[model samples]
Target: MTTKKLTWVSMLLAMCVLGANFKLLGSIALDSFPAFLGAMILGPVYGAFLGIAGHFVSALLAGFPQTLPIHIIIGFLMGICMFIFGLVRKKAMGDGIMVKAVSWLIAYIVSVPLNLLILYPVLHEVVFVLFVPLTIATLANLLISELVYAVLPSKIKNFGQSKVV
Candidate 1:
């Protein structure tokens, strides 16, 4: 398949996953699922769409505060971070644990400030004691998500392969 077709397919799959996540879990956090995996598997742009669209829909349904701006920023940053992972993966082009680990690390690092600055304030919680736990949770979620994606069957992996020809 061509890269463009692959991207569109990935985006569609990401959106479906995002919707299922929100519907089943009710939040955009680890409770539902991590957006980072989608970002990592699909390219940054598709990943960003997944993150932003997922959060926006979840917020509307769950009554989350400052939905648009916060999610937009978070999605964009997370996408950029995941894009880095995608680039690295493209270079390595390997489905190994090391790649997954690095991708998780990148997602966690990017999510920390985004959550602390953009999300916490909206939730009306101080970033004092909550910061550490939140960071840990975010990291954990990213790791689990990456692991899930990395170990997916070949059919699923094929879903993410770029067809930009």
Candidate 2:
């Protein structure tokens, strides 16, 4: 696909995934998978764009509440995290497993603080209990992103290869 098409596809996919995975204030959520997948398959810039688009959609859907600025900042940071994940993957340090593991690690490290201190505070309208859901959601997203990156495309590719064979 052309770059523009790829970007559009990635953004739309991210939005869909975010929409599907959204959780209010309870339970862990794995909303970052699409952006992570986009980062792995596409490039950092596209990943960032996809993340931003997804966040924007999610924020809009959630309704413009008091946390609009916080959402925007979180969205931008998420884009940066995805972009960095893409960059690390592009380095091709080892196999896909290692790349995804490290990328997930990086995302977790960055997201934990941002989610707990920044996003959650805005979300809960309080600061004390912010870490709970943020931690849960971030971990969930990390695991989900890693698994999706590790399995999805390869599964499809294997199925295609087997059919061809």
Candidate 3:
């Protein structure tokens, strides 16, 4: 990638790590804000990087309460979620409102099945416990990211469009 692109990614990565400090519950935190931002700005690949990296950082800080392996899988899932979030936004380009609504809805929608695929089997009884925080965090993360992106000046918002995001 170009140096400029690298710098933006690095900045977002740092933001992601910083966000990892704010814990909502267990390994869930506000880190995905930067991931979503990176998705919308730098592209899905970069967003995936941020998502995985952010989750790992959050998990690490939380002492991997759910185990490293679980967190690792979750990290990868988060990466894929970021990828789809960016992909949807990229595809639904013109209408900003629709882009935000559809992408956020789709991201949240996909997360359920992906999470349930493993979580339901592993924690069949208590799996429902995570749903609340997951929903809260997911909405907060995406909404905050979208709001920030929406408010950016047109020129600033165009920062990485040419490359992909």
Local distance difference test values of all predictions, in order: 0.56, 0.63, 0.84
lDDT of 3 by residue, 1-165 (tens): 887789989999999989899999998899999999998887789999999999999999999988888888889889999999988877675746767778888788756556756767766765577788888888899888988887988775677677533
Candidate number achieving the greatest TM-score relative to the actual structure: 3
Of 1 and 3, the candidate ahead on lDDT is 3
In model 1, which runs have C-alpha deviations exceeding 4 angstroms?
Answer: 1-28, 31-34, 66-68, 114-125, 129-133, 162-165
Lowest-sum lDDT 10-residue window in model 1: 23-32
Ranking by lDDT: 3, 2, 1
Model 1 TM-score (2 dp): 0.62
Ten-residue region with minimum lDDT total, candidate 2? 156-165
Best by lDDT: 3
Off by over 4 Å in 2: 1-21, 24-29, 96-98, 115-127, 153-165
In model 1, pairs of residues that clash are 1-163, 2-163, 2-164, 3-163, 3-164, 3-165, 4-164
* Model 1 alpha-carbon miss at residue 104, Å: 1.2
How far does residue 92 in candidate 2 sit from its true spot (Å)?
3.3
lDDT per residue, candidate 1, 77-131, as tens digits?
5556556655666556576778766765666666666556665656566545556
76-131: candidate 2 lDDT, tens digit per residue = 88788878877887666554667667777787766666555666645665544646
Candidate 3 regions off by >4 Å?
163-165
